[model samples]
Target: MTNVYLTARFPRIAFTKLETNGFTVDYYTGRDLISHSKLLRKVAKADFLITTLSTVVDSEIIDAAPNLKLIANFGAGFNNIDTEYAKSKGILVTNTPKVSTNSVCELTIGLMLALSHREVEGDQMMRKDGFPGWSPLYFLGHEIAGKELGIVGLGNIGSELAVKANALGMKASYFKPHQLSEDEEKAQNVTYKPFDELVKTSDFISINAPLTDENHHQFNAEVFDNMKDSAFLINVGRGPIVDEAALLKALKANKIAGAALDVYENEPVFDKKFTKLKNVILTPHIGNATVEARDAMAEIVADNVIWSSKGKEPKYVVNK
Candidate 1:
């Protein structure tokens, strides 16, 4: 039997299909994510390795797995894995994309509304202490309608956000490495702007870009200083895209109005300072936590492993 090692917990429904393909699949049975030491030992003899954003597939891990032929990532972003190193070792890498677009977009807009309306703060105060009755000026929040929204990435999730933002009476604009064609922009009802222009003008800035070497820490102290003091920042993208320390400084200084984030600079162990702030809304990277999306992700990753195991190319190869 071909040895296949999975570094994280996944849906068994998908694993059954891989099991039928004549591979002995193994995964972490612990309540928490598997540790790197444990993962190193498990993947030592793996023919195929299934990875997650939490797992770091560095050069050391790649070199240890002499039988490893493929690294099938569970999410759209593969930055966690060292693709360059993997390719140099003649291993294929694939990611499950498009399946979580709707799920992530919904979370992005939800965060926008949450930050604009101070939804989490209101709920927390209500649950912790009894209401002191109604007042003329109580629980005030910024209105979402008639606001300008700037999207940082115009990919699948960002484009969908624009469509939803327009329906909600917000002016949607975007800045991406690649600009859309005139016809595409007209259909989406989005205006293109330079990155600086987008930051300075938007009432709410949403980041939906992937983490890349060029744009890592894309939103820093300098970027925050350029933003409007009343603007809200929302990031449903990778954590490293925003500098955690800079974000903490901005929040403490009230440089921006407020911020909502689903991903953190150091994931699963984000800065403890974020919890003390009243103007921020933090989530545990649940941008694509919906059941439907996860099941589809499981199916896609399983398909990648199955196809590649048979010497056929997977559907979503990133390096090729």
Candidate 2:
């Protein structure tokens, strides 16, 4: 049997499926993230190493696992793994992509609306005390109708947000690394915009861009300065894409109206000052947190592991 070391616990069904498919699985079952030292030690014996976004599978871990054939990631984004290094070592790395589209896109919309409508504040108010009757003067927020929503990327999640924005009666514009064909833009009800103009003119800006070398810290102080004071920023994409320091400075200066984030520059470590801000909404990287998405992710991880163990090319190979 192939020996698999799952660095973290995943859905139970997927675990069973992996074992049934001819692998013996060892795992770290704590609720917390596995430490780097522990990971290096545990992965030494695995033929396949299954990891979550929170785990960093660097060259060190890959080199440590002499028999490692594949790294099966439990989420759509595999930034946590060192793909280039894995490829150099002839280890396959795979992720679940399409399965997360709806769950992540839905959360993107939820974040946009939640930030725009002050949903978090409303929830806090309710939690703090009794039910206060509605007042005409209470909780004034931006209306969703007729707003210009600028999307930073037009990937699966971004495209879906654009489609949903259309139904909400909002205008959609996007800036992608590569321009979509005219038909794709039309299908998504999206118009292509230059990054500068999109940031300056949007009523709400949603980031669905992937993180890459060329676009790191794509949103900085100058970009924030160009934005309308009433504009709200929403990021459900990779966190480092936006310069967190610049974001904090902008927030402090009220350069933009508000912002929402599901990811952070530092995984699991965010500035506490963000917690005090009434204008911002932060989610715990829950873009793919839905039960449906999690289960599907687990299944994909299992499939990839099984195929790799059988010496077959796995689906969802990122290095390809």
Candidate 3:
């Protein structure tokens, strides 16, 4: 019988589909990450592997899985897997894309609302010290409506955000390498702005791009300097896209108003210094953590595994 190994315990749908199709499915059940030795042992006898973004499927791991025919990633981003090496070895790599689009887009807006309205700060204040009284100016915050929103990288999430922002009475503009046609921009109700221009003119800046060699550390001290003193930064994309040190400096100097981050430069680890500032809002990378998104992602992964089990092409091949 064919064997399938899951690096972590995901939703049971994946296991059900594999097993229903006569494949033996086994997974790690630890709360913490599985040890490398344990992972090696698990994959060595596997015919297929399911991975999360947190698990690094590097060259060594790939080499150990001599019979591995497929590496199905649970998340939209597959940067954790060595795609080139897998392709070289004729191993198929797949990702569940667009499954988390709505969840992530909603979280992006949630982060924006939390940051702009100082919701987190207010909550902390209420818990630590009882609200003195509702004074007119005690918790003053600017409304998001009528504000200029500059989105970086007009991908699926970014496009959705533009529509939502427009509905909320905010003006949305975006910066991407390839500019959309005038007609396309009108349909999306977003204007195209150059990167420097968008950063300088917008009241809020959001990062929705992927992690790539050309744009790593794209937002640094200089970019922060160019932003308005009252502007706020929101990052729902990869963490390294913005320089954490530079962001800390900018916050300390009041170069910009504040920032909200769902991702960190390093996974499962972040700068504790950010906790000291009331202006900063941090989330534990829960952009796609909603139940609906996870279920959808699991179904997609299971579908791909089923297809590959029948010696057919999977629906979402990333390395193809």
lDDT of each: 0.89, 0.88, 0.91
**Span of ten consecutive residues with least summed lDDT in model 1:** 5-14
In model 2, state the lDDT of residue 233.
93
lDDT of 2 by residue, 227-281 (tens): 9999999888899998998998899899998999889999699988888888899
Colliding pairs, model 3: none
* Per-residue lDDT of model 3, residues 1-320, tens digit only: 88888988888777787788888888999998887788888899988899888888989999999999999999888888999999999999999888788888898888888888999999999899968797887889889999999999898889999998999999999999999999999999999999999999999998999888888999999999999999999998899999999999999999999999999898688999999999999998999999899988988888888899898999789887
Error of 1 at 115 (Å): 1.5
Candidate 1 RMSD to the correct structure? 1.3
| TM-score per candidate, chains pooled | 0.96, 0.96, 0.98
- Please give the lDDT score for candidate 2: 0.88
Among the numbered candidates, top TM-score falls to 3
lDDT order, best first, reads: 3, 1, 2
lDDT of 3 at 251: 99
Predicted candidate 2, C-alpha RMSD: 1.5
Per-residue CA lDDT of model 1 for 14-108, tens digit only, reads 68878888778998788778777888888888999988877888888988899999999989999888999999989999998899999998888
User: Backbone collision count in every prediction?
Assistant: 0, 0, 0
